[model samples]
Target: MTCSYASRARFHRSMTRPFFSKDRISHFDIFEKHAEDALNQVKGRLKEGYPVDFQDMVCRFTLDSATEFLFGKCVGSLSAGLVYPKDSLPGQNREYANHPSNLFARALSEAQSRSMLRSSMGTNWRLAEFWSDRIQKDMEVCHRFIDPILKDALERKRSTKEGEQSTGHAYAEGKGFLEDTLLGHLVNCTEGKADEIVNMLIAGRDSTASTLTFLVYMLSQYSRVLKRLRAEVLSTVGNSRRPTYDDVREMKYMRAVINETLRLYTPVPFNVRTSTEAALWPGVNGGPPIYIPPNTQVPYSVFLMHRRKDLWGPDADIFDPDRFIDERLKYLTSNPFIFLPFNAGPRICLGQQFAYNEASFFLVRLLQTFSSITLAEDIQTRSPECDKGAGRDAQEKVIVKHHLTLYVDEGLWVRMGEASNSDDV
Candidate 1:
């Protein structure tokens, strides 16, 4: 019973399973079952105008949500409006002081934005180097924070060993992804083992944060899209009950909105790959066969590709979910080679299913709960007044900073009101 509780309680999947499959576990499923628990904990605080950083809230919630599904223990980031302690895995926090997760999140955000701008300018390679150094420093903060948790997981796994089989939960139940991957790798591979665990923590924290931040911003910016999403949520789950994973999966419009948002503002704006060997496009008797030697580094800029006019049409800039309404998905072929939000081909995101399901669940819930959302006054009022530069196009004004992931310079801020606002108005 304790084993079951422990397995179901945390975010990291046990080490016995394949390392890659760890993230495939879905926290949205847990969120659905514990919806009332989360709401009862948070609703009162939200009602009091406690000035919760909604963006941070989403990140923390995703963190806890993902962790619980992977491990069996749920850290109370969302419930207490704080980060899970790096030490005892606090079932709850005694006070609301800023936590490691918050500091880590903020540091990652600043580091990424500064780095992106420096790289984009391309004038000084030295600036890029400096940013890289800062990122490394911030990473130390992350390592110090996650190492203890990983150690705790290892100790727990040790405790559960031997003839506890049959009745015993899998290692994933107790130790989670950290133990599973570390233990497996120790048995198999050599070198840089600790680095992989660090990568997971950094990757998990920022990717979920950036994606949800962009999603919320889009939902706030486009009212019609927001309404359609909310309507779908209401029709499928109704107002009183929480949505199951199946219900979230089946919500077509909500999925479409998410797809569109991802298309426009992917979490990873760019990815780079060096050509392993020479490659070619047939029937192009132009220059040489585009000889990409073995050592050549090729970068794929997802941001530019997603925004290509030839692919998405003139209104590629627009946030229209109807682009995905067709049954055959033909409309999506504006540019056959375009749209690699999660990347395409063999190396696609393994956690894509988990991300979509989680995002869909959260988005639907947010829409169901909130009626009106508008840009905060300062961002809305000052955006037009800011002189981007002498010749900078308004289209180019979309700031893309590379924090842990690409985050807007300022966190996406918006005003949200109860879903009944329309009725009252």
Candidate 2:
């Protein structure tokens, strides 16, 4: 356990170093290229008058960008193209569904679901898989796709001797370009452990994709919010040009919308941690302290916490971005723990800023290209019938599915209205 913790800390440090530093502006270019590629595909669907699955497009965008950041070459999931809505005029293309990159994504998602089940079942999870290991089967598919890339990276590493010069373009003065890929950095930090790389891939791909998916879903529901957000995007960055990091930072309303979406639909909604030692919890309203024994498993739900009426006021259940920017923000400012979308403390998400940048960049380009978004409820596969009682979940238009990270059930099928030349600022 100590070794595991130390290894993780070392890996985290490596990631934080030059890769995510403020000066590493090249990453935004990569994000912009992927976002443009994704939006271009969506435009194709729009011209064809076919509804696109926004969730799937964002997933491919993140996957391509994450792979490029990690391996110096993307899996090119975008090349497989945006999938047509189920039973739509184009129908589900067999070749597109069976693309190697798509297969890897499907396998990775399955592996995550199995891992979540194993964690939920604790020590007895193996008992259920005694006859057949489902996760292993899924992982085999993933490995089949990734192993060739790993082999190539390993070969490249072996060719470079000690103190050897790199052939790639240098990003800064005196800093060589070999460390550009996270995989190469991990090779030096953690000896290229496949599992650690996979964990990073999951972190890079799903979390941001989930956030974008929900953000679009929310914008579709509230036209006023969408109009305001698009205005911010157009006014700040214009319609034709790419947005700089500074430009993204300047858009306060856009940030508020992103924050509100994360507050309501955090990608990793539930988390569990084991106590290292006995601890006492402060009671609410001067009540007695609660006892927590050492090594006890503690599971918490940020989803429920972010929605509590007492914490967020009576309109907590409503999808309002104003809570993040208006007077109601005091509730979180006073007690910041009430808003932990990417979590808090030492073990908080290392890629939190990266996720924000990628999401922000993509959203800017998305709103710039598309003037309006309307849900294709007729083609949406998931129904809210399973939700019981009252409140947000009960009245949800799109069903939320939990598989390690939150995702729209079936997919967020939407018809986006393309912006004309006059729509540009």
Candidate 3:
């Protein structure tokens, strides 16, 4: 039987305290290494003259960072330097050897997709997952692939407590932020730690990766936005050194770009909630309130809502980072419900700040390292369905797929290179 729904919620609430504060998750060298790995992936792919898979690069980067941040051990997705070969074994088709935890990443993706399918099934969701052989296999793979890593973390934490603290401490000495992570605090966490840790990993990995993937894709298409962001990064971070936690916060335009991207793409386009008791939801424009019966499931689309003309004005659909900075901003702070990228409740993402830090750090490093990112000419665009009065063309439209989060229907393919002028920005 499942237990601790309340306890798990409480645990996340407790976890959020350290995760959200200004300098909280600040000491993160794991993020720095993974960010470098992401840049390196792009660099390698650029030299090959083939379009780099922005999706895979960010996916590996997030997987590595999330694992190390949460479990005290890295999954090594980026470090392996492998471009996963289709229709081949883990390490079979690339220059770099694949990480063994590739199985874990694949399993986690499959599991999330399967769960999304089930969630779309209303009250009878479990029956669908129960009946599907593919889902059952996904479950098995997840258990087999991720359990050992969880066990290792638990063992490491246990050992550290039992006369090994001095050893771990000595090892952490002189390594910047070596122990500044969530892992060290979990030593005394009892019962349900596995589930809690895995839940965090699932939240931590794909959402950030998907956001970064889409951000890069959007930036390539929206060069003006990228230029401004790169300028902000250069002005704040400079080219010679990696950014500190404080440096990321000071980049106003970078934060605006991220907020705008989150507004448009919102990794989890919508979320669902079931009412345990009857309730009333107020309607818009002074309309009558609507009553919701008990056991009713309500789904709200943050993506569609964010683009509404009523809230965002005539050019609501336009990709503009300036809105967050100038007079156009509202709803985010004034009316929270209309703009719930991370949702508006106790269960709101505990790692939201962690995600911002990770993204900001990487973007700064990326701007410092690369001159330009452009859509690869060899790659075809996804066709648009009915502009229905909008002026934008079919090719400029984005096509996305929904699992637990959104992904580009076709992988985001782009070309990148070293910056021509370090002082340009």
Candidate 4:
């Protein structure tokens, strides 16, 4: 979809309104605000010596934001600052809200669930079964969350149906995204389209959250880089007001910083696809043919490719946002596969632009408030233990695992302090 500033603004306003008025998913609208708010919240936590739990915060933020956009009401997570309402109805809470017992609880919960399922499962069709269950669970949550809203919307539609002039078509005027779409696609998509929306939320929230966490951690590790980033943010965005979308777009250094973070700590580390026909991959001599049956799985490890020494050089492991400077990337090869944090090919992430806006806005807000980010003494002592599961031998490794998406075994914890008083970097 071609995302326009006007379109984003419209979606943002639509989400805050009582009725879900559009038939399309407007992720940019929902993510823009929450991303900045989330950064501020995380920065506060860091300054107070609170452990950075990206998984829990990301899951809840993404879920609630996506839910609000899809259903036209806050999920009570983001606005209320609660994962799940403690006094909510039990069965309803499990189905509609993010349950503590569910995989939606934290990053570790999801990682561990996938790990256990992978290890103890039957090799024959375990993956298929797990995927099926996951889909079912996603559908259940979507339906429960949207059903009541949809019903109310439909009722409102019916009340205004007789009086309103239609193109000989019966439709709901003040319906949410689900109802608006149903007004059109109720014929073809006989199954739960609500689940489809949930699937999109599932795909978006955690990955973005994980990426932001990594970005913050990296900023802390490279304090000097964070200083430059803050200078750039302050110069471009200023401190008098929060940044707008346009301000975020103009901050070149902040943009590069986020791009570098995606390269180094990709949230979705790998993607699997089955080749429908015999195909040739790069790097092999003579373009050697690789055989694949219809159902054969092909794994493309993005993490490995992003950290490829041939593409990024000896300093590939270094957290240097300057690598993204035009002078640097200009000398780089034009290979598309060099970086795939959001994937490449036909099935790349659709919410890429929105994610960028949110991440940038949040980072800008964070740096504006904090002077510096450093590793706490206690956190530093546990670095080895934390890094054990973090998937690599980097200075800030934490156990990272590929469940459905990549997530740290623990969380991204850091210490943030006041920024340098000097406005100039």
Q: What is candidate 2's lDDT per residue for 98-197, written digit by digit as tens?
A: 8888888899999999999998999899899899998998899988867886776665555554224565543341223246777766554544544567
Where's the lowest-lDDT run of ten residues in candidate 2? 169-178
> What tens digits encode model 1's per-residue C-alpha lDDT throughout 129-212?
764565667656655655565555555555545325755655555434434333333222322233444344445556766777
lDDT of 4 by residue, 1-425 (tens): 12353364344333323222222433255665666666567666555545545555666666666555544555545443422212334213544444432433443334435544554453654656754654446445445655776565445555545435555544445433335432222212233223344444565566777787777767766778887888788888675457776777788888888888888878777666655555545545667565556544576778888887778877777777888885568435466568777776545565676677667766776677677766444533244554454334746545555566666654544556655456455
Where in model 1 is the C-alpha error above 4 Å? 1-29, 32-53, 70-98, 107-136, 162-194, 280-290, 331-337, 379-400, 420-425
lDDT of 2: 0.83
TM-score of 2: 0.91
On TM-score, the leading prediction is 2
Q: Please write out the lDDT profile of model 3 over residues 45-137, one tens digit for every residue.
A: 667655677887788888888888775678887765646324335425644433466766777888888778777787588665575555778
Using all chains and alpha carbons, the TM-scores for the candidates as numbered come to: 0.71, 0.91, 0.85, 0.71
Give residue 138's lDDT in candidate 2 (0 to 100).
Answer: 88
Say which prediction, candidate 1 or candidate 3, comes out ahead on lDDT. Answer: 3
lDDT of each: 0.57, 0.83, 0.72, 0.58
Error of 4 at 339 (Å): 1.4
Deviation of model 2 at 197, angstroms:
1.7
Task: Rank candidates, TM-score, best first.
Answer: 2, 3, 1, 4
